[model samples]
Target: MSRPLIYKGRGSLGNAAGRFEKHTRRAEDDGWGSLDAELPPLQTEIIVDSSQSVISYNDSPDIPFDRSINPYRGCEHGCIYCFARPSHAYLGYSAGLDFESKILIKPEAARLLREEISKRAYRCAPLALGTNTDPYQPLERRQRIMRGILEILAQTRHPVSIITKSALIERDLDILAPMAEQGLAAVYLSVTTLDRTLARKLEPRAAAPQRRLETLDRLRAAGVPTGVMVAPLIPVLTDPELEAIVSAAHAAGAQSAAYILLRLPLEVADLFEEWLRQHYPLKAEHVMRRVRDNRGGKAYDAAFHQRQSGSGVYADLLAQRFRLVCRGLGLTGDLPALRTDLFRKPHAGGQMSFDFFD
Candidate 1:
């Protein structure tokens, strides 16, 4: 049998078609030499998103915030276990390689946000960034969409929260630090694993674990409220580092911490399983067995409360451990609440409303 092809820096090994596609295509090796011919590395393709609006709102009980801004549609970090992967299918793209290699950017995000929030019926609340994808992903360096959005948020004195796995956020400390000083900003760095090798495989293009910790420290020093998320705590793969991750974040100046059980919604299940079979063949079966144990003998359970942290002996133990470690490290509280009272809706002419001094 032909061995599976591996792309050096990419996370997904295959590019299966999106579920909504009416037809599917498969690669087949024929007698000709073309099938196995060496091909050039795939390049990232940037597509402009022509969305008229910038803010997305959701009422899911599991989510802490109602409104969020995703400057980009597909994430370049290419984490195989990302629950957001399935969302790519809606754009007629695969949940695997295509999701990482094909990016959609909203160049007008800041303008749209300003228009939306300046409306008479608009309400002020803490808007979230990097919820569906990393706002600081590599393209942000060239696109600068996120920076423009932050500039508007800062100008309006609007409350904003962010989560990212990239060190690129440091570049915006000038904007974030001042907003944070006014209780209008909070940031969370998502640390998957401290193992360099695993991180390279899991999120090939994201920042290194140690670099994220250092970034957290810098944010804290700048007076930016910092939090750490030991996300997607895989059972056999990353469970052992639970306490270590919390302790390390505390030492790195994180004021709060949280975690999520591995989620395998839709195509993410197959992609993640394939990744395990390729990277951890020996422990693949055991890892999945434990995952199913946490999911009540299934690959996943989509129930809101049960989804973040499954319901089982192992899940219970993991939660108890997290609580204990957080308590010991004084990480038991949430990040300080963001301020919405200071929000100022700029007029159509780009000046603030005149009722301030009255």
Candidate 2:
């Protein structure tokens, strides 16, 4: 008997037809299995990449950071609304299961980061981690690639910022605390919804909402600067809890908070649609209709300014609600910028020296 195919919304897992091929037309016309399927089994694949580059720079006008490093590709968090899912298609992989199951690790990330930072022309800035994909995903527990990157940054006194939804980050408090004390580091924990059942289905592999809150409290008590991020505020599904999420974070010791409207870009649009129809068929149409209204009748709008916050009456209302609630809860504040003057490149002998002494 043939093994049952794993239906991952877009197509069957591991099937050549699911892989992106050049010069292939009418691909969508191919018949696939039904959309309804039980939980897909987790499959892991190891890939060794030999590349000289690791840090990525972005020039988006609205973004705060210019440089970031993603130690891993295709996050295992398996968030249905992930905007980075389309990246897997570039590797001839499906944006559905392949985006979550197939893992890529950058073992040499620390070496390259050190080489880059040691350059005479290197400038000290707040290097953001887990921007494109999570650096502390499940694989990090075993691979320890994110830990390696943190070690290098700590040695050089390089300023860094981290954003994650995993309690696993608490394990690095030993390194983060000192940096934070020196005003060299800060962290933002993303918490989407407080409802456990909804969180499980929306972000299948992320830490439970309560666990993330506990992590935030621990970070604050450790003298590490921390903030809360209520991201991807889904309409009708998780939107109702926006104010409550911010209030809870504030009470948990988060000094500040921010939020972003849900973005359905590229393959994420299809994946989210499939998830909505399957899980909340009653509200699927209403959700998509609101989403389209926010995007000006399109599935997504990539405009820089309007991308983070949607455009339209509903989007405006959500924005207003978030602003009002954040102000009321005293959670609307920006973290102090980390000091860069303290940065000193370590010498080859594992010591740091300053030229001012001479």
Candidate 3:
């Protein structure tokens, strides 16, 4: 059966197509003529992921935050280049389409966060939301865990930073706007490309480029500190749109800008390679050639300082261009610090506390 390169409203699962040595979901010939040749309809499955805690701490020097919270494990937005795809393997799921369709949810994220934050030794620092899989993925509209976490952060006056590409975030402005008023929150909306067609094929389920721009404007108008992240900059595919994206975002009220180079780590490398072969067959070889150029002749370089920004001719040039364009548009601005001193644990109402116990 001839598999489809693109699905209408969804991203193609990486597991169903292409050749890889190892995979949990195996495709077999059903001997059903056209049915065998056609891509089957895929459905999204949300599984409950019970957790012992919600907050995850990281000490990576390159990452700005020491802690983050991922309300879900696998992302349904299905960006083919997602570095988080490999995370699904730990759950015995394929990192391809299975990673996009099979999701894991932390049902008690908000409650656990409240418990963690209310502990005596817990010190406040800027915690990032959506640092791994997007906490505001399409499923967030229904799950609302992200909103719950935001509520807990709001009630405790804990500072946070959010990064996402979903327009659903606009739905939480009531919580976000009020928090923004006190410098407790900021947002960085990501726009990968201005071309809608390319965006559909690339990110599959993410909002359109124009919609993200509108969201940026709305966030800024609501007094939320907004910025733009032109992330996972593919060498030949979306790299050309860098300057234009930065300029548009700046005009849309983005106060600052940042970017990360394409990272084809582990299973993601195989998935993206197959994706390139399917969509950009003409330039697949050329594209990966440049990717390797930036990755130091390897599929990826995990070196911390050198990882976020790669090392190569094109990488150096891209950095130079980003700096020049950001400076020209004044996308660099001093951001207000999120207030840790404002943190006050939520009072467990109606709970008995002995007066002068000790």
Candidate 4:
């Protein structure tokens, strides 16, 4: 077998072909000695997504929100275990390295969102951000697409729920704090693991676990309802930090908590397995065994209710432990329901109500 390819700060072990690709390619060492030479660093490529619509509705019974807006198609955070990675294949890109390096940004997201929600038939409901990919990913710093979307939402008095692992959200306190004061906004920071070293490998470009906690505290201090998500809880790897993460978030002023067990769907399964073998070779089989125990003897099961948190003995235990710890930490309740009553229908020309100014 050939040696694994490890990019300095990237999470994928290798750039595997997407599921739809008919051609398969691999690197083979010829006697030329070029295979051992250092590879050029990967650069992020940005593509503009000219999609006319911004809101995507889903009927998945597992999730709470019905509609969501993803300003970007591929995430730059390079999380090896991202469930959204497989989605890159639909765009004719690899679900491995290409998913992080090639990003599709929607520069007109705000205008499209304004047009959609301003319609006479449109109904107001809390819109979700970061459901598919992190809205505050590193690219957002320069793109500011998320900020523009939030500005429109705030002006229309629309309710929104945001999830992210980036400390960059702190910079939007001026916008979020006021919306939250009116019960129109809530934010959840996904804390995967408390160990800084492990986190760097698992989610290479995301904010450190400690930095996320500090950002949560800052958001709470600014009167923005803040919560914590112990997301993608890997069985034998990061599950041990569950209780500790909840406790730490509670200490940091988290008012609500949630979690999702590790999900390895389609191309994500192979990518994650490669990551596991590269990072924790000895424990890879043990970890996958525990995952299969939860996933009904397979690498993954996509049944509605069983997909997020698996269905089995191990799954039940994780759920029970999360509930018990949350109860103990006074984080059992959900964030206040966002208000739709304050929504103001915009004019046909996409002009927002000026009631927000006064």
Candidate 5:
């Protein structure tokens, strides 16, 4: 068995015990005798997926879109606060370092998308991308699955919305730019903090804040409708820089903006706490204190609207600050609605056609 240690460019507290296992193991570092010293550095492990379908739909009122797609199951960004971390436990992996090192890719995602969109009963709506995991993560450079999906969307004139923290999205401007002109595409760059040091630990593999800003600028310059998302706003942590992030993104050519409070559901709570102890030990208690303040004295409140915007005075104050800043910056609660009338269904022979009367 391979030993486990923290890699230089990864974000994790090393492998914690897998939650589903019958027995659990603990690591002790009393100095007199420590087992952690002999462990080898953890490495990324790629897992190929066999997805039967590509599009995932939900009827949740909390979500703005009815359909979304996650090209990969596990994200390489390694965000310590990622709510998606617990999802790995379903695959029998630990919610700690295992979530960051193990990556899963759906090789036939594009082909599956093409088939689904070909159905005669298909409905055209803005497909949300990167809702679960980043479609433009580092593995994308080799997989090219996202690029293939974009090509199909562009060819079919399907509307789509993308949210990511990667600069790699700029590579698909060739397809996105044309779709944007027809009101069929929009992009949102999620910026958590302006502090490069914090970002390095927060999401070790994600693009830097400056690089994301550059990506937004390039996308807008290419005529792609772009926006900014100050997401998972951590109280007393990244919260202090919320306004600054929006301002910087605005200067980078973002016309729309939004924010979401941090979410630590399921096993993510332990994963994140472990991360805090490893990197921000001194401030961990204070940080989590404020996190619980807005979450009704809990680490998280999963109640619909309250989930995105916490409850209580702290939550209210955060909301008010966001409203004031958005008003001052001329941003509103609207993003351009992608066009559905332009959708063209491909015939059985692979020829696309749209009926004007219908």
Candidate 6:
């Protein structure tokens, strides 16, 4: 791994220059460790910006929800395979470690969500969370942005669907439980793999698989509609565990299940390649070969319909495996639609309509 050079009181450009100097010195010294042996502790920086609007609209035919909200930019989960990793390039940052360490929080998200929904043109639909980045990432613990958004949704009696890999959702059972009772909420717990060691390295900041299972149980017990998402099923890496993961999630009280095949787009391809070489060096070549087979002899194929699930015999087999296991486990192929009929706009000075009903 190439160590990022740090320059005290200097920005990224200065740091790069320092790295060049260090490289020259190391080459002259015949590859010896620096005499000052201590490495700097990794620091996470968060900048909170107040977004004018929270709800973002999407017209993609492949996605289920038309509207979504992301409370934070650049996830802390550190999943190398995340297709959203490429988004960090817009910020002039590397999609590798920088994508996980530099986080942007939307502090005014809740207020903006309320304002958007109160508009006369606003239509009722299930608002999705964690679509681009996990809404319940570790930073949410302190920022409470997701919680604030949920609170607004609850206040308006709006429908919501969340996809997350964190146990932090348990903390909002007070809000989710009530919303679920009214058919206003559903949750999807994303479990990529059951292997603890692999999960630790692949998704360093995410909650453990076991903890996620427990979270599902808690949500089910609380009467919150819940399901499991075995997302981005890697070709050779976690593919073999498809059935096992579905069966285990079923046993853990997941009412439905879904999966997405691995997608390597833009910077994500290079980032994932680096990760495979670093962690699964022995299987690196095999994995990339299978991935290419799925992608029609390339690292990725970005055609609209073919983007989510690749095209090939390997992709077909993976889909077949998922369908068979899901049926055997008696899990619903898709989540029940959250009720949008219950939605109401909350006014600034007046109480919400639901409050009068209460």
lDDT of 4 by residue, 1-358 (tens): 3556677778887777888999877777887776788877788999999899999999888889999999999998999999999999999889989999999999999999989988889999999999999999999999999999999998988999999999999989999999999999999999999999999999999999999999999999999999999998999899999999999999999999999999999999999998898889999999999999999999999999999999899999999999999989888799999999998867779765568644
Q: Give the clashing pairs for model 5.
A: none
lDDT of each: 0.92, 0.82, 0.85, 0.93, 0.86, 0.82
Error at 156, model 1, angstroms? 0.4
Model 2 scores worst on lDDT over the 10 consecutive residues at 9-18
lDDT string for model 6 (1-358, tens) is 2443332221121111111122322112224666335446557789776668888899988889899999998888878688887777666666655677778899989888888888888999999999999999989999999999998888888999999999999999999999999999999999999999888877877899999999999999999988999998999999998998888889999999988889998767766876787668999999999999999999999887788888999999988898888878888467677888877788865456656245
Best by the TM-score measure: 4
Indicate which candidate wins on lDDT: 4
Q: What is the C-alpha RMSD of each candidate to the true structure, in Å?
A: 2.0, 4.2, 3.8, 1.0, 3.1, 4.8
TM-score of each: 0.96, 0.89, 0.92, 0.98, 0.93, 0.90
Clash count list over all predictions: 0, 0, 6, 0, 0, 0
Cα TM-score of candidate 3: 0.92
Cα error, candidate 5, residue 282 (Å): 2.5
Error of 1 at 107 (Å): 0.3
For model 5, how does the per-residue alpha-carbon lDDT over 170-241 read when each residue is reduced to its tens digit?
889988998899898999999999999999989999999999999999998999888998998998888999
Tens digits of per-residue lDDT for model 3, 1-358:
3454344556654474323435444444467664345465678999999888999998888888899999999898999889888888788777787788899999899888888887878999989988889988989988999999998888778899999999899999998998889889999998889999899888988999999999999999999999999988999999999999999999999999999999988888877888889888998999999999999999899999888889988999999999999999976664677888877765545222332111
RMSD of 2: 4.2
| Candidate 5, number of clashes | 0
| Higher-TM-score candidate of 5 and 6 | 5
lDDT of 1 at 66: 99
Model 4, C-alpha of 56: deviation from truth (Å): 0.3
Per-residue CA lDDT of model 1 for 15-75, tens digit only, reads: 8889999987656666676557775687999999999999999999999999999999898
In candidate 2 the C-alpha lDDT for residue 339 amounts to 86
* Pairs that clash in candidate 2: none
